[model samples]
Target chain A: MAVSQRALEAAGLGGGRGRLERLRQWREQEHVFGYGLILPALVLLTCLVAYPFGMAIYFSLSDYWVGSPGQFVGLTNYREILGNDVFRQTVQNSFVFTGFALTLKTLLGVWLAVLLARDVRFKRVLRGAVLLPWVIPTALSTLGWWWMFDSLYSVVNWTAIRLGLISAPGPNWLGQTNYAMAAVIIVNVWRGLPFFAITVLAGLMSIPREFYEAAEVDGASSRQRFWHVTLPLLKPVLAVVILFSTIFTFSDFNIVQILTRGGPVNTTHLFATLAYQIGLQGGNLGQGAAISLFLFPMLAMVVFLQLRYIRRD
Target chain B: MASAASVRARRLRAALTYANLTPFVFFALFPFYFMFVTSFKRNAELYNLKAVPFWIQTGAITDHYDFLFRRTEFLIWMKNSLIVSVIAMSISLVIAILAGYSLARLRYRGVGSFGTAVFITYLVPPTLLFLPLSQVVNWLGLSDSIWALVVTYPTFLVPFSTWLLMGYFRTVPREVEECALVDGASRLQTLLRIVLPMAVPGVVCAALFGFTLCWNEFIYALTFVSQSGNKTAVVGVTADLIRGDIYYWGSLMAGAVLASVPIVVIYVWFLDYYVSGLTAGAVKG
Candidate 1:
């Protein structure tokens, strides 16, 4: 992250006594230049990011609504939301959605990665195919999933019935609570799977091949090699991916918004979607702000651990 | 006999690998294929419960696409999406290049704190702040316009692009930049003229990802812009197309296909850069 000190000294050694020299003299003060360079980024982020973030906290604490003058209410919004059953359902739904999605993503991701890392033909094409789900926009792709899960023309149910996996007119996917959750989870897993596969593939590619040879030298089976050599070395990458995925999954909005709109008795509402429903559509700015702000503490803990984990390395 | 068995085992493992990958590939791509095929099938075939839903047996037609263009504001939304993505990506890249160079190459006092600030800012998800941001946008008179998206898209884009570019900028040799400095080139001049050229790939990588993010963003675009003409493609397709409970499946799929095609095409061409950006964001941490 630095130019050599010798280079700085060498830069300072240049001699001149004119405007060009003044400019050269200015170059030696590198930190000033660095500060100057970073200012625009700082300004933009402060106004757009930090200010809005601060306002979010302020919003949750006040009795605010869209276009209404909000007055400080000191946790009243939080208390009201805490008493709400729909909000409670939302918290449970978020955890359930995240729990199922992350578990599947991790297991499938590592397996797909190991498979991708193998010496296979058309590797680039295969890798590209696997990564396609992630490249497409979620709102659009989830619409595709929504079409497949349609109550009447549900191809998912159609295939299931044809294959004898379920009975005719199979479960009302978006209309029934359990089926709706499953449909959303399935789409989430479908959308999020490639992210896991590709990232883990990168981690797999980074491991030294000699580790495998060394394991085999000691008479290790392929399973043993994976368990002992690959999985342990992959832990750091896995942890980071999990943490990031947890944050992404917890804060997810588009999938639920498009697929169910937290339908069938709000059985599948995530915090973001709940916040949208309550805050924007319901026009309860304080409650919406509070609902979303609830995610902050948990995610901040994840980010903290993430920073600590990365820093330790 | 042992040599023959070992060869057979190798062949067996090879077959197993593809077999395992088959389902994953299908799971990953079948929805897209479904979307594409559904977009083309005529309404009669699509709604015929007796017909096989997997393929277009009644021959492909562009009627849905024709209806989308003729009846809906699909073209306006796409044009808006393009405008927002281009403007936001360009601004984020410029800011990210400077910030990335600063954090990666400069050893100034408080540089560590600034880096942490960017890191902290990057972790602040848009979901959490969209409510307050909507208020902010209202105050700025950018409500119901693409201008709101253009302004706010950079919040997420800049931190990510800066973080990604920070890792990328670190990989460029310090000697080249230092050499440029020692030769009496100003740091700004050195950065702009010498170091930036070498870091073009990083810039392009950031640009590609930055553009993808802007195009793919939904919540802010959905929350910020309400006008049909100002809605980004993703938001417009979802918010406007499906009226009441009657989803125009064929035309909806068409809208989905049209909205997703540009970014998908871009990603297919630069798959490597895109993956590297993904890894740089997650793995590098």
Candidate 2:
């Protein structure tokens, strides 16, 4: 009887060990299959992103045009762009556009989120309506704005005249340096605010009601509660909004191209449109590449700082 | 006491509501209102330029629409855009879902950290790359072809699509897949029959994202497609605007309205999914 019972226990142990081995083999096979699954993405990225990056770095140093023979210029292209007044001004304009656009959008977005959070009539309609400009393609909408600002026949001019806001139809909006810049900035802010509002609304929703209740119970006014309670809670989303807006505004080409085409004597030029004009249109590939090379450092600094803030949040 | 408290709360809520919404309502809707009114006016009326049109002209003509369709290459551009967008969206969706599932569920050597790192590459600005890419396109002999856009768009699409799909795939329970494996199903079979159907929302979300990204693409489209007839709708629309002394404002607005229709419909249909998809991984900094 003892030998029979010992044999039974040995068989049970052997069967359990076999199942474990089988499971291990299955896991190994799954891992292999998993790698196979990711093979397409890996290959696509390597060819599309990685190769292009290496090529960009190489071309930045070479004097290459669309139809002309390429020659190695080696830092000359970079130096030329660095010294160029238009390039420097564009870099400055990008910062200005980003700074103003981000600040206005954030304030307006937060205010909108706060409004939407309260009970209001037609809230659903308002919510849907607010996202329209953002939903519309930037190219199409900016084109629409272009017609509105037509120097020959501007509706805004007509209206301002009718409303007695201005004495005459006024100067050519697209021709003037300052008004053109202001128009583009306004369009950027208008296009960007929906994203900000929706994102900030989501952020506001994540904050606990108890914080506001606590603040109110302590006899805090709405302003006090906002500064002390809402602002702190909303920091992470605000940071993200600003960061994304900065990146997008910095890289923006469509609106500027449609409206001004970096015109009014290049007063409204940004790095991206200028790069396109110099490189592709003017047929100076190296110079265009040089203008764009600053993209990496500028974007990296903003992304790095914002990412740190986000991580802390 | 309860009645007084309720009344006070109602009044406070009303005031709060007004305060929150006053700026955004005007901010969002004014441009749309302006566009609608502009589309209805005759050239003379449009040129007359008033603050707002006083009357809705039953005489709003479809002449601009006719001009856009017949006079310009608008139809062809639209057709090319549709063909390109559909193909790109379908490819990205399928590839992204498979890769996202693999990254989310399966363990491989160095896959975990590497997957997240791969996603960061999406944030790299295209401004730096387009010039060199133009050279690469020239070398490949693909300049002035729609096919060039097809090749390059996936660079942007795949990373975002994969990231979104990965986040989405994580929310699914593992037990569901285990059951499929236990039933003698291969991983592919399980992914097809069990994983995909369950992950339709995510797949749909990825498809929409891919579709929009390809649709709204400009820089590469502008750089690559050089021929006038070969231009995409985005490039084509701008090209159409310059016909020397005859700026077709009505047709342009009509085209603008037309271009946004498909996307607007998409938004209206699947807004909740679209919003969640766009904003999900976006906040991760």
Candidate 3:
């Protein structure tokens, strides 16, 4: 109200007999206009994100299934999930998957970005092709990988055998537990690398050429320039990309669901896929919600750290 | 002699650069290449492990494409994806434009916190919300309909587009709106006539990104829509084409290729906007 009143005054709606009354009216009008403008988005967010989020929290605390009403149960859902071996395995799997994928994506992304930032023929074409894994839908692309990793018809094994690198067919990529996990991680890395590469390339391109020239004039070697200047300048962008990718990969459902379906004794069940398996498929809404939320605290911390970094920048 | 040495050095560098790039290029494009070639192989060629798997040594066939259109619900899935994406795009665009304008230009209370709220909402991953959202979809009686996606997609889309558009709207000169107001244009009129026209690029960027996000969305579509005919392309192809122990490799690859074509076409055409939109959104956050 105070801000709106000041705005009304700024707009010269303050000039009149009974000026305070006119100011109030104008303030009210501005208030209405502002809220009206934002109402649709606000309402949609409230209904979709906020309400469901609240419901998820509640569902995690109760004994709710799909159709029936849930009764309040204090810490029972969390305790049960913690005690469950499958739940423990899923948590470990998620961390392993996210850690491996993020590390590979960052390393590969930086290498690719540096290469792309160079003057090369067919750079645009290469960049466009690099983005295919990302631009296409994940499930569809993962399906292709699933076929490539198929035990009987795997092209990878065929290539390997044809090249005389292996005497027998390649290992069953998705049949064994460890192999299944590797397959999903490989697909995740493949899908996410383009995002990292493209974003980091954008960051690299924005680095002022004058900075490099100055470093060169000071007799700085290429490694010294990269360590001293490029890394420091690229920190903000790198932080944002890493955090974004971490959150995304941690919550990833598509690759795991489409490729292995968290199979071979539940070895590759990510939190999201596990949640869907338990909560939706098994119809144990309460336990499913609890499993899904196991990573909420970590996500909140990441979000908090990211917001702080954003503010500092 | 010096000139010859420098020329040799340059040639070596060029050769080494291309050699280094070979792995990246192959890693990026091989899956699609495999998918394309596999889509053309006959059932016999597909199952034959003795033949060269990398290329179609035999003639290409359209049997998979024929099966996809004539056998499965691929077309319905495509139509559903288009409808849901378009409607979701329109809704998100309209809401985002207005909210972004308000947050950027309007002097109002709680604007800062409201903007932050929107950003935080963008960070809330769909994994946490999908279960409860499924329940909400059921409650709204939109469980198996495309409308479920149409309404729920904005959960992620609006926040993102609003944040993107807010950044764009802030770059719009304030004087343009002030001039419109000074010329006795109503606020709504100023927004409609002057501000919106100026923000067309931002709007288009937001719309394109929104559409792509909607199209690529998977979990919600999988959870909410159980019926075969109601699935989106991504969900339908993944869920329907693969049966137990018997993968329809040809038809599945065909579906994958076709499902990808629309968004791929748009991405290639507007590659610049898509790249900028992604990086800009990331950098702003």
DockQ list for all candidates: 0.79, 0.50, 0.67
The prediction achieving the highest DockQ against the true structure is 1
Candidate 2 stretches greater than 4 Å from native: A1-30, A306-313, B1-16, B19-23, B49-58
For model 3, residues A190-306, the per-residue Cα lDDT tens digits are 999989999999999999999999999999998899899888888888999999888889999989988888988899999999999999999999989998887688688778988
Please give, for residues B197-260, the per-residue lDDT of candidate 3 as tens digits.
Answer: 8888889899999999999999999999999999999999988987775748999999999999
**1 versus 2: better lDDT goes to:** 1
TM-score per model for chain B alone? 0.97, 0.91, 0.95
- i-RMSD per candidate, Å: 1.0, 2.2, 1.5
Alpha-carbon local distance difference test for all models: 0.90, 0.78, 0.89
- lDDT for A109 (candidate 2): 81
Candidate that would win on TM-score: 1
Clashes of each: 0, 3, 0
Top candidate by lDDT: 1
For model 2, name the residue pairs that clash: A115-B20, A158-B49, A159-B51
Q: How big is the positional error of residue A189 in model 2, measured in Å on the Cα after superposition?
A: 0.9
- Model 2: per-residue Cα lDDT at residue B27: 66
